[model samples]
Target: MKPGLMMALSALMATSPAFAYEIGDSISPEVAEKLNLQPGKAAVVDFFASWCASCAKEIPEIHQFIEDDKSEKVQVLGVGVDEDLAEGKAWQKQLNITFPVYDDTDQQVVESFAPIGMPALYYIIDNKVVGKRIGAVNHIDKQIRADLKELGVEQ
Candidate 1:
């Protein structure tokens, strides 16, 4: 392959969003139950740490997306991997995050996606992951709109 083409491919691979949990992956029973409960919906699951700069930066835009979203068929879930639940709660309060957040301090839920970098993201529809933006997405609103459109969901 030409060097320039190879480099472009390399960059794309490096920035690819996620290796999300597949249908059979061992997810927490509680989370599985939640999925079972939401029969048909699109979802954005953001995994972040309290200390991660990129994660901190993404929170406000995510909140704005949730607030401005027109579709009621989607849910935004945050999984905080902070070492302590209290720390995660404090961070959420500081950020004024109102969406439901799951405390994964035990790392059990996250272990299903080992090697997933901090600020990992998953977009799901109909109980299946359709997009995973593993890192910060520039112009997140636009990206979410595109993703939702693909999932036949509008936000």
Candidate 2:
């Protein structure tokens, strides 16, 4: 290949977003309707997996974040990308989470909103996603707090 072509390819790969995702995009119409049916005033979707250690660690912070009565306005929905529903449910149980979890083993949701990493957060205000965290490693709390502020959601 020509040197210029090689350099161009390298630049494109380097500049690509961490994940193959689009923001400010609406979910599939069907999913949107299902989410709308849920009782929470605000809906935030978390894309996670049973195998990711990072996802495991963020569970408590997410629980604590939603402990207040304000959570009635804010419902946290967890989408487990695990291939097996039973395993994912077990992990959810271990986390002591009381929210509903859905299975997306086919990666339908994952493809539509490619998360940067496990425990990725998509902040949905009213019914649309307005803020997001690609990945925060061990720092999800600080970043989520900022995202909440951006959404005008008090902690």
Candidate 3:
């Protein structure tokens, strides 16, 4: 291969989006263990960073969904993908987030999922991904409710 061609290919590969998990893809055991997934229960795993404004905005709405959740058939989990642990914790504190949030300072969790955008939400059941929402979403709480219903998760 020509040097210029190789360089061009390299650049293209570097800029390309990483492989993100899709519906029917199973979450790796390592990732599931990191998230502490509960068996026989569905999961809504959200990836966020302290610097992402959309994440900051959507978290509260997700919390609202959690508050209104009555069936207890699904678990909501958050992955704080901030490189600075203190900043992430402080943000969560400011948001008054009550759900379990994993501090992803090392970025393992987020990298594994490889969402195309920030503020990503993944719905999982039995370790397999069932649904996903990426980027800023309006009325995120309502969106989640509808998504869960479509996935056959009881509220």
Best by TM-score: 3
* lDDT of candidate 1 over 1-155, digit per residue (tens): 99999999999977653454763344445665643425567778888888888888888888888888877887888888887889889998998888888788877657655535778877766555566777777767667778888867855
Candidate 1: deviation at residue 13, Å? 27
Candidate 3 stretches with Cα past 4 Å from truth are: 1-19
lDDT of 2 by residue, 10-96 (tens): 999776543443566555665666444354455677888888888888878777666643545567778888888889888888988
Separate clash counts for every candidate: 1, 0, 0
TM-score against native, each model: 0.76, 0.73, 0.87
> lDDT (CA) for every model shown?
0.74, 0.70, 0.90
Q: After superposition, how far is residue 78 of candidate 2 from its true place, in Å?
A: 0.3
Clashing pairs in 3: none
Error of 1 at 50 (Å): 0.6
Error of 3 at 42 (Å): 1.0
| Per-model RMSD to reference | 9.3, 5.9, 2.9
